[model samples]
Target: MRKKVLDVAEEAFQARGYHASSMGDLMATAGVTGGALHHHFATKKALALAVIEERVAAAVEETWIAPVRMAPSAREGVRSVFAAVAAELERQGFVRGCPLNNLAHELSLADPDFRIALAGIFSAWRQAIADKISADQRAGRELGTDPQRFAALAVASYSGAMSMAKTAQDASVLRDCLMGLEQGVMSSKAGTRRRSRILHRAL
Candidate 1:
């Protein structure tokens, strides 16, 4: 029952801003009574936090971390990650932007707890990408690359693209951002390959 409430809340919060979504609203959507809601969550804030901790965090992990973890190359992994997500947004018609970012923009400024929760997710995401880039750098696959900077750039770029797509009601905004990112990464890789060829010829 707790999980069911949370599932309903997640959808509602994403569709309707958290501030606008009341417990009464959720009760109606979830088909639960007031007693049932209070039984699991003492307050609306508690329920919202749980939604962030569970549903939103899990989405980030599945969308970003898992893909990076399973990739054969960190560079290609990052590119493919963006590609896959952009394709998904396009398929969905870009009507819905990122849930985490949506909530962050809506609630981050109104409360400290919400800010902290969203910031933690962003930190974890940035670290995951940075770690992958660092590993590639160590392996000489991305020599001279600043992992931290690149990770920040990637996150910023994606977040900004999502916002633009949402505002324009066009998935093409995300697709363009993903394409630019992929081109930059592939170009860097190609430069590395050309350098290797030159070094080999010199030797």
Candidate 2:
């Protein structure tokens, strides 16, 4: 029952925005009575916190960690992460932006805890990318830029692009972002190879 309430709360927060979603709204959506809600979550903020935690866990699992684990190579896996996000946006017709981002934009100002929790999620995501890029670099896979900086930039750009796509109601913005990202990755690979050759010649 607690899990069910959290699930409904997450969807409600995503759809209605944190400020606009009330405890009453959550109870109605979850099909649980007021007693059950109060028993599990004493306050709306408590429920909201739970929702944020659950969302962060899910996003990490489904988007960041899962893709890297499933891909044949780290570089290819990073690209596929962007590709999967694009596919999801296209499928949803650009109606929904990222849930964590949405909450960050809407409720972070009001709740410091919310901000901290969401920031942790974002940091984890960025670190996941960085770790993958670093692995690829150590393995002699050419990624053109500094692995840490490139990973940070990629995650930032992807998030911003998703936001722009949602605002513009155009899935093409996401597609274009992915294309540009792909180009960046390719260029980085080339640069790595060039540097390797230069070092070889000097040796």
Candidate 3:
């Protein structure tokens, strides 16, 4: 029952803004009495927190973090993620945008607790990419740019790209934006290698 309520809560919150998704609507959709709902969640805020901490966090892990970590090359993994999402969105014939980002925009400023929980997810996401980039750099695969800075830029670029895609109702916008980012990163990598070769010859 708790899981069922949570599933319903996540969908409701995503489909409707936090304020728009009233408790009454949730109870009706979940087919639970108000007592049963409150027995599990205590309040709507508690329910939202749980959704953010659990559902949203898990989605980010599966959708973004896992892919970035799994690829043989960190930069390739990041680019593939962007390409895959854009392809899926185009196939679906709609643009739902990034789920974590959607809620971040809606609830980040709504409450301090919401902001903190959401920030924690973002931090974990950034850390994953930064760690991957650092490892790749150490391996001499992508010895360009600061890992933390690149991670920050990637997160922000994806968020902005998703927003643009949603507004334009075109998934290609995402591909375009992300591809530009990749070009910049690859240019830096090439430049760094060139400088390294020059210094090696001088030594």
Candidate 4:
């Protein structure tokens, strides 16, 4: 029953803003009594926090962290992850924006707890990307750019592209953004290699 309530609430909160999705709506959608809902989540805020910590955070881990961690190259991992997300957006007709970003935009300003929770998720995500970049740099796959900065750029660009796609109702925005980002990464890496070669030749 708890899981059911959470599932229903997560869908409701993601589709509608957290404030707009009332407990009555969630109870009706879940087909559970008010008592049952309270037994699971005493407050809507508690439910929202749970959704962020469990569902949204897990989604991020699966979609971004796990794939990048397992990939052979950070460049390929980042490119492939974005491409996959873009393809999924196209498959779904670009209706829903990112769930975490949706909640962040809606609730981050209204509540301090929500702000902290979303910031934690974003921090974890950024760290994962940064870790991948650092690994690639150590392996001589990426250029000399700061891993943290590159990770921040990748996350910011992806989030902005998602917002643009949702606004335009077109998935191509994601594809184009990712393609341009990947191209820039590859170009920067090449430039770094060229500079290294020049220095080596001068020695």
C-alpha local distance difference test of each model:
0.85, 0.78, 0.89, 0.87
**TM-score of model 2 (CA atoms):** 0.86
RMSD in order of candidates = 3.7, 2.7, 2.1, 2.1
Order of candidate numbers by TM-score, starting with the best: 3, 4, 1, 2
Winner on TM-score between 3 and 4 is 3
RMSD of 3: 2.1
lDDT of each residue in 47-91, candidate 1, tens digit only: 999999999999999988778877876667677877777777777
TM-score, one value per model: 0.87, 0.86, 0.92, 0.91
Q: Which stretches of candidate 3 lie over 4 Å from their true place?
A: 190-203
lDDT of 3 by residue, 140-169 (tens): 866667889889988888889998998889
The candidates, ranked best first by lDDT, are 3, 4, 1, 2
Winner of 1 and 4 under lDDT: 4
Compute the lDDT of residue 50 as modeled in candidate 3: 98
| Best-fitting candidate, scored by lDDT | 3
Stretches of candidate 2 above 4 Å error? 185-203
What lDDT tens digits, residue by residue, belong to model 2 across residues 47-144? 88887887656876698677976676666776787777777777776457778778888877887998898888887877777787777767776445
In candidate 1, which residue pairs clash? none
